[model samples]
Target: MNLRNKIAAGTLVLASATLMPFLGTWEGNGQNTVYADKLARGLPTVCKGITRHTSPYPVVVGDYWSNERCEEVERLVVQKGQLQLADCLTNQQIGQNTFDALSSHGHNFGYVSTCASRAVGLINAGRIAEGCKALAWAPDGKTPVWSYVTDEQGRKHFVPGLHARRRAEARLCSQ
Candidate 1:
């Protein structure tokens, strides 16, 4: 082989070695992942909930490790979910409650590992009994515990709304 051919061959070899771990031949044990997103171009279809996809193009000698290939994909997924949940929480659906944000924005899953939002979801789903029961097992316990400090008149106001009301009151008093 000429010098240029030898260099090209060496590069091909290096690329192949780098991509070996994610070549789609290695199977996952529900532990360390051997493949990135999908297993192969056409994974055999089976099971009730399994999904599959086909690769758009042939695997070259040196494809970069995709984000879907990392060992910490689960962690990354959780982090992404947390960010998403925060965005959802900040929206007007819950009145932008400060209690939710203070309580890790309902991502605590409590000490017993249950999402408080699930109970809330159930109530919204018209299964109040089930939702309350679910929250009873949550970290803070009590199916629908509201975060609060009593006002002068003792109305149970949502924390964020209370802050807004206080601000408005101050503005009015200043006027």
Candidate 2:
């Protein structure tokens, strides 16, 4: 092949590589994808705030996908993700941040799974005692709400003010 042909072929190869991440996905957040489809069916609310799929190729050619597009994939997905249920919030940074945020609000006790995770991460990160005392809002388990505990001692515990909120996680724990 001539120099021009060789360069063109190489460029095409690179371009295809960059496009691979966006190749098979849905269309939201300007081109989202379907992840954890089952989860979406079961829980639409959680997905409402997350966009599906992470781009192995999340570049914007002047605001479009192009070049080395992967570095920002985690940032864009996590910061601005509104995914569906069973959408695998694991890799999404937005998921992590959401979880961490809800968890970290020390005085409040009503948090879902994501919120709980965030709190624990922040607490542990801060070298705080992450236990029943970590939360000042937990009440007796009778209020139909509760904060979740790590299953370390073969028993579950709750914080003061989180009554009804714990109900959701309780059901999951039983199963």
Candidate No. with top lDDT: 1
Worst 10 residues of 2 by lDDT: 43-52
How far is each candidate from the true structure, as Cα RMSD in Å?
22.9, 17.8
The local distance difference test score of each candidate is 0.30, 0.29
lDDT digits (tens) for residues 66-89 of candidate 2 = 222332453344332222211322
Model 1, 96-157: lDDT tens digits are: 12212212222222211222365445534655444444433343453233333445566554
Q: How many angstroms is residue 20 displaced in model 2 relative to the true structure, after the best TM-score fit?
A: 20
| Runs with alpha carbons beyond 4 Å of true place in candidate 2 | 1-36, 42-70, 79-127, 131-175
Prediction 2 global C-alpha lDDT: 0.29
In model 1, the number of clashes is: 1
Residue 18 C-alpha lDDT in model 2: 19
